[model samples]
Target: MTRISRRHFVVAASAAVACAAARPARAADTVRIGYIGDFNGASLAAVATDQGLWAAQGLQPDLKVFTNGPIQIQAFGSGSLDFGYVGPGALWLPASGRAKVIAINDLGQADRVIAQAGIRTMTELKGKKVGVPEGTSGDMLLRLALRKQGMSVNDVELIRMDPSTVVAAFASGQIDAAGIWYPLVSVIKERAPDMVELAKNADFFPEIAFPTAFVSRNDVADDRSLKVIAVLKKANAFRAANLDASIAVTSKFIGVAADKLATEAANSKFLTTAELEASAADGTAAGWLSTLNAMFKDFGRLPDPLDPKAYFRADLYQAG
Candidate 1:
């Protein structure tokens, strides 16, 4: 049997205790977290699972991991979620209706684009099928890329697919271009070394300094709002402070290679409360919100502009 290091054993033992301690005290009191990215397959979930972030706040999380924001938002609207993460573009659904954004979550620059073999430029995608969840953040980035070249979603065949499915589709020759996040991004690039980066997140929505966050009203009313933030903040802090250890734990929890987590941790940008709020108040962020709303309207995803103010809850960050 392999002897685990003392640090690894300590962290692992602590994780077991934390998982047990984090259980919700009541059904109504449970803070349902709808994570809309590669949650199970990524480092964020590992941080939550191992570092006792949720346990520290007395939160009972109904954690729903997803591959795209639209599916996660659907869960949010149906009254099944308390808090979750979303891309900047998917903010329209909640902004127009009920769910609220509390912060700017992860800003992963390398999590943006991974070009497949045979595609050298955005112009090369004129007649190819590109995979992205329609009306989500990746979708927004895709639109921005197209517009730069005097094109639109109509210019290329858009395949509405979950981010998780993107890699498989590419492997099967179903998609010529894929927009995905870490681990998957790493996989695609490794598989197709000759592919070119058509665009990155910064290249498109430069104003979107980071990804968006959301929480249902029920969580707010239940007094579990601060608990959610506490969990995320603690996990984020742990990730920031102990990158290697966190990566090892995250690798086991997410079931991805440890090397991938190391790569992601090196490239991902996390936000402090001050940093998060500053971006929320940015005129540039507001403009991006407006543009996102317009795109949603044009795509028939939303009927009109969703007020950016309605969705953001800066007080939560301030309190934290």
Candidate 2:
């Protein structure tokens, strides 16, 4: 069968669902999971499916690849998905009572501020055109990075552009810099090798954690959620132990070249089962969510920051 690319799947999710329904009957223990088709924490869903890890857990995986978090959240609300991998941009969905954050999949280290070789520090970005995809974690990172340097968006000529446009404009010299994440960051570096990284998501660290989470519907069964987490844990171990093999399978699943996918995957920092458990135990995960909440509110994207505990279900993760 011909494979569908992630871009195609985004526009034809409904049709894909219809096609899934027409396939031979699946096992009764089917689990409907949703994730963004990117090289972030959510990409593990593709690995799980490719490795039959879900089946090993007795789940007939009904995996839906989404273009973004909001669309995945919509699927969860419509009862089409039982669990979803949400990025930092939409972490507020759960805080708003729309879902429950069951696990912190990974800390986002894939985002970076890339600028012309001459621009070495965040403070130097003053008055320069910086491309940013507003409302994304990259945007938040840019704001925080600037703030850390006692600067703000007002210090820069912020040029709003989608990820793809940022790549093109940055490469063509239309923008002085861009706040973007991988694999687009990878793309930009390849297209403009002269560009230098000014800062990264990791630079903000504990002060501003950009984490991607595995979230579920508030009504999902505990047992099923536990099973999902178990399989994901196994998938994480597999990816860490067998990076090349993981990239080979994920490349086919994501429809990106193996080398490119490997580059993109290397940019992220996936948490181990131990790391995840520790973060939850130490209140680190909750702290991360709270930081994200405050960033959104500061940006005027949220009315008010909700308590992290309102959505972060550390209890569920512990039970797993």
Candidate 3:
């Protein structure tokens, strides 16, 4: 056996210690997040993850992504996630079933149903198969768009599919149009320019909105929920400050380029913390809840219209 010199021993010991330090820690403050829809802005959440903002705030989230709301909400109910982002219908899931709503994330901007391929407008969709994730905000918004134009779901063929699957349906010509959000929708448009964009979030419905939320077991919010809220606030600030960089980072995660990601980001409305609060309190969210309840009531998604105040937790804003 060779005797190690003092310098060699010191270097070897340092290396061993460094390697041990590099091992993943069992984060005591982990906050697992289940996300879906507008994976564009969810990229902001990704920024928070990559930058360790969650860790800096003494929280860690195991982030999982899905293409629709109800499925992610299922993960939240089944203990796979501690928090989730969902649309209005997700409220019905917990309200109508067994999950719970902790806080409202954002609203007013979600994906839209675009009539592709020389399709001129919503009315042009008559006799055409319009695709949407069944029983989601996208679906609700699509229905509302039809109703607003004095048309009904009967006027068009309804193709119930996951948002992820819509791209393929559109490509295969199985569906005349799709109600999808970006960056998938944007990708479809790029591949098929003949696919006309008949409606977008801004044009289809007047201020119809969805939710990106933080949902968990009822007790998770009892202790460290405020910390989660603060981290989201920091995330919103970071997203506001670094829109371009955020888009580029998102492009990598979504497998798209920076410019294409920017296009989707442009279609979205990024809310400030104060805007989030006001909307949650007395603005679009309040109005949308009333609207959502009425629509759900008609669609049988809800037993009846729920109170707007009952749908959100104002306490989270206060806690933040």
Candidate 4:
């Protein structure tokens, strides 16, 4: 109906080991992989579960589902999540904290400025009330789009809300335009058939790549994490052969239909394990992360940015 709203421990000691031997393994032994239930990256888990890849990898993932990045960011801060497939802003975590990026998920299309029927373009949005889900992908893109247009948030009445609430506000005539993501993006289209998407995420091109990616506190080097990534990569390899069935499973997960997801899947691209590893080794991934980190800081999303090099592990050299 409406939209809304992770940890691990290990100890090794001679005496502590004897204590552990006295009891069976507890819940802490299980893997907790956090994921946003949003369609943007839901396929990772859907394919993993549907194809039994995670099981094959010997991981029974908790599969924590969140509404958006802002919510997941808290989990990261608390060290509750081991991995996440999130929007481009994943750089924010690694650059500033203990996270590291693994691979790119997709280039977003629905992160855009949607306005009421009468509004046709960004220029028309001047002096109108527009909403953005703070610290999310849509918010980041909206800021960049405005900057590119030679306009600023000062030119409009900026309202901040979550993606789901943005749709509700839009439906209630509380805001004229909003920076939103799916299924809210799809929800808006369905509920307001005449609505106009004034600017798509792709419009602010060249300046930012807007890559949704897989990020982790424990990267591929960790044996447990590596198993999970291997499973995910297996799912990626099988995606083509199982396209229709994959979409059917993902559709139910994202609460959208197979046709809609099929369209989104067409617009997205994936990288194999070898391809992603090569990108990191060659500096392609690092360069993009560096640029996007600086971009978010410039946009006021990140007040104090950290070095991009710290975002990835030294072994992978992805932050080079």
Question: Evaluated with lDDT, which candidate comes out highest?
Answer: 2
Candidate 1 per-residue lDDT, tens place, 1-320, comes to: 34568778888999999988997645434676766434322455468877666666666566777766666667766777656677666776665765776655666455454457666778878878889866666676677677778888788888888766887787667888866665667777676667666787667435544355555553365346766666666666666667788778866765678887666556566665455556655544455466667767766667876676656665665465
lDDT of 2 by residue, 23-124 (tens): 987565888888765667456787788877887777888877765666677888788989888778778778778898988878777888899878888888
The digit string of per-residue lDDT tens for model 3 on 105-217 reads: 55545467777667888888999988888877667767767877998788988888887688888877789987777677777776676777655567644645565565555
Off by over 4 Å in 2: 1-26, 77-80
Candidate 4 stretches greater than 4 Å from native: 1-29, 218-221, 313-320
Q: Go through the candidates in order and give the C-alpha RMSD of each one to the true structure.
A: 10.9, 12.3, 6.6, 11.9
Question: Which sections of candidate 3 miss by over 4 Å?
Answer: 1-27, 37-41, 88-91, 94-103, 108-110, 204-207, 281-284
Better of 2 and 3 by lDDT: 2
Output the lDDT of residue 273, model 1.
46
Which ranking of candidates, highest TM-score first? Answer: 4, 3, 2, 1
**lDDT for 291 (candidate 2):** 81
Question: TM-score for every candidate vs. truth?
Answer: 0.78, 0.80, 0.81, 0.82
Which ten contiguous residues of candidate 3 have the minimum total lDDT?
94-103
Clashes of 4: 2
